[model samples]
Target: MKVLVVEDSDRLRRSLGDGLTKSGFSVDLAADGHEALAFIRTYDYDVVVLDLMLPGQSGLEVLRQARDEGRDLHVLVLSARDQVADRIRGLEMGADDYLIKPFDFGELVARLRALVRRRYACKNPRLRVGRVEVDTAARCALRDGEPVHLTPGEYAVLELLVRRSGTVLSQDQILDSLHGGEYAVSSNVVQVLISSLR
Candidate 1:
């Protein structure tokens, strides 16, 4: 999955980036609300981890604008504001989930996964398409109930295709989801991945 981590704190941003990358997500970092909004507009991300307190614009404004544009983006507000009113406002303004600061990394990851599943309208962690089954929770795939080993890039692309099974995604969308503007690869790369998946 691809995720955008929008936090003003450099250390927390880097830590979240490294941890989420290791946990099998393509991550992009934004320091503040302006950069966060830019990334949100440009990329097709599965989930966004947004900090409420930001420079330039507040996170709520960013969320509100993104929603106003009608982007199907799932945002999880990660803020230090633990008040009930704050959570209600965040959710009321279109946040999918809200987590307080100093949260468990594992819980954050789980919440992100749940949001992605919700995005795909998937109620289960295991997804089946024809003879292929993807155990998203396990981060593995199986064909005929047997293991099918895939490179990380191949798996990422396959998961993207599976999540948007009925929709025809453009090459640019695929590339954006897979690399999140972090890599400069040609369309041929996506073609190769598609061919390999086939």
Candidate 2:
């Protein structure tokens, strides 16, 4: 999975980036809302971890613009404000989930996983398609009740397919979902991953 962590606090941003990287996500960091908007415009992220208080532009503004432009990326708002009204407003502004600051890292990861599953219209964390089962939280796949080892690229492609199971995803969309602007990917890489999965 790829995620964007948008926070004004340098320390918290770095901590979340490192922890999320270790937890198996490609992460991008933005100090404030403007930087985040730039990333959002240029790349495709599975989710955005946005902080409400920001310089240049506020997080809510970022969320609003992204939604207005029809960007369907999942957004999880992180704010120090824990008030009920604030939470409601964030959700109303198109945030998939809201997390207060000083939250447990584990909880954040868990919530992100849930959002990813939701994006795929997967109500169950353990997704089963035919005899293939994928544990989204564990980042592992099982085939015929036996574990199937998958390279990161292959797993990423599979995840994307599972997320949009009933639809046909062109190669460009698969590439977008796999890597952001920071990393260069060959056009045929998506095909390679799909062939490998087959």
Candidate 3:
């Protein structure tokens, strides 16, 4: 999965980027809301970890702009302020989840996984389609109760399709979802991957 961390504090930002990378997610970092907006415009991220207090623009403002622009990005707000009103305001502004500062890294990972899963309605973290089952949290796949090895690219494609089952995603959308703006992808790559999946 790919994630964007928008935080003003350099220490926290680096920590988040490093920790998420260690957790097997491709992570991008932005020091302020303006940079965050730029990243959002150019990339597709599974989830955004946004800090409410920011320079250039406030995190709430960024969230509002994203919603107004019809960007359906899942957001998880991180704020030092843990007041009930603040949490409610963040949710009202379109944040999917909120985490207070001084939090456990494990808890953050669990919450992020839950948020992403809920966004895709992946009822079982172990995703099952036909004879294949994918354990997303474990990053493993099985076919007919036996292990089915897959390259990272192939797994990414399968995960994207399974996350949005029944939706006919065009090739461009598939490519964007897989790379998250970190790499340029060929438009025909999706077709090649789909053929391999079949």
Candidate 4:
């Protein structure tokens, strides 16, 4: 999974990115809200780690803007503000989860995993399609009780498709899900991955 970390604190940013990367998530860092907005517009991210205070724009503004644009990005607000009102405000602004500073790295990972799991239920944990089963948490696939091997990219594409199973996900949508705030690859790439799934 890919995550965007929007934080102004250089130390915390690197620490979060490094920790998350170690946990098997692709991480992107944005120094402030402006950068965060630009990244969000250009790429797709499964979750956003946003700080309430920022240099250019406040995290609340960024979150509100994204929602207003009809982007369904899952946001987890990380800030030093720990008051009940602050938490309430962030939630009201559409943050999926909120965490205060000086938090346990383990807790951060756990909360992030939970948020992603809840947002993309079929993608984060496991997906079942007919007799085929894909275990995302384990990064494995099974067909009719037999194990199936899949390359990383192929597995990512299949996971994206199965996650939204009744929906006819366009090539761009699939790419967005897999890349997450990264550059969009060719639609033909998705076709190639789909062929591999067969």
Candidate 5:
């Protein structure tokens, strides 16, 4: 899944970006609310890891603006605010989940995965489509009981297709979700990736 990490702390942002990337997520980092808003508006991210305290605009304002646009964006507020009222306000403002700082990396990754699954309305971690079985939790795919070794990009495309099984996704959709808006590539790149998967 693609995620935008909106944290102002340099160390924390880098750490989260590195950790999330290693955890099999396409990650983009934004240091403040304006950058975060730009990233969120320009990219098709599955989730945004937001920090409430930010320069210029606060994370709450970002969340509010994103919600105001009526986009079904999954946001997980990662803040130092631990009070019940803080959490409730975040949820009320449109955060799908909340995680306090100094938290476990595993739990954060798990929560992000859960959000992606929820977005697709996929209850099971393992998705089976005909002869191919994708173990989303394990981040692996099996065909006829044999493991299929797929590159990260290949796996990402495969998972996207599998998650939206019945829906027809255009190449542009795949490109936007996987590469975001800044990475420029040939129009046929997605097609080549799909062909490789086949």
Candidate 6:
């Protein structure tokens, strides 16, 4: 899945991006609300890790604009604001989930996964399309009862397909969701991944 991390702290942004990428997610980083807004408008992100206290536009404004524009993407507010009012406000503004800073990396990843699943309206963790079954929480796939060893990128692609089984996703859609508008995606890359999966 594609994740946009909107954080003001350089270290936190890098850490979250690197970790999420390692865990089989395509992640993009935006230091403030402007960059985050630009990315949000230009690309399709499954979720955005937003911080409330930004340099220019606050995260709330960004969230409000996204909702007003009818973008159906998930927003996970990751802020230092841990108070009841802040959390309620974020959710009230259409954030899908909220996590406090000084948070556990594992928990953040888990939450993001859950949010994506919810976006797809997938209730089960085990998503099965024919004999190709995906254990989303475990982040593994089984083809005909055999485990498939895949690279991080390959797994990300497969997971997206498995989630949207029986549907057609264009190369642009795949690229937009997987790379978060960073890479110049070619048809060859998507072809290669599909071939590899087969």
Give Cα-based local distance difference scores for all models: 0.88, 0.86, 0.85, 0.85, 0.87, 0.86
Question: Candidate 6 — which residues are off by over 4 angstroms?
Answer: 122-198
Error of 5 at 16 (Å): 0.1
Give the residue spans of candidate 5 off by over 4 A: 122-152, 158-198
Q: Write the per-residue lDDT of candidate 4 for residues 7-37, one digit (tens) a residue.
A: 9999989998988978878788999888999
Residue range with the least summed lDDT across 10 consecutive positions in model 6: 178-187
Q: lDDT by residue for model 2 over 126-194, one digit each (tens)?
A: 877888888777878889999999987777778778767898888767776764343344667877788
State the local distance difference test value for candidate 6. 0.86
Off by over 4 Å in 1: 122-150, 158-176, 179-198
Residue pairs with colliding backbones in model 2 are: none
Root-mean-square deviation of candidate 4: 4.6
* Superior candidate under lDDT, 4 versus 6: 6
Q: List the residue pairs that clash in candidate 3.
A: none
Ranking by TM-score: 1, 4, 5, 3, 6, 2
TM-score of candidate 1 versus the correct structure, residues matched by position: 0.74
lDDT score for residue 32 of model 4: 88
Enumerate residue pairs that collide in model 1: none
Per-candidate TM equals 0.74, 0.69, 0.70, 0.73, 0.72, 0.70
Rate residue 77 of model 3 by lDDT.
96
The superposed Cα distance between candidate 4 and the true structure at residue 150, in angstroms, equals 2.2
Candidate 1 lDDT for residue 118: 89
- Candidate 1: lDDT of 40? 87
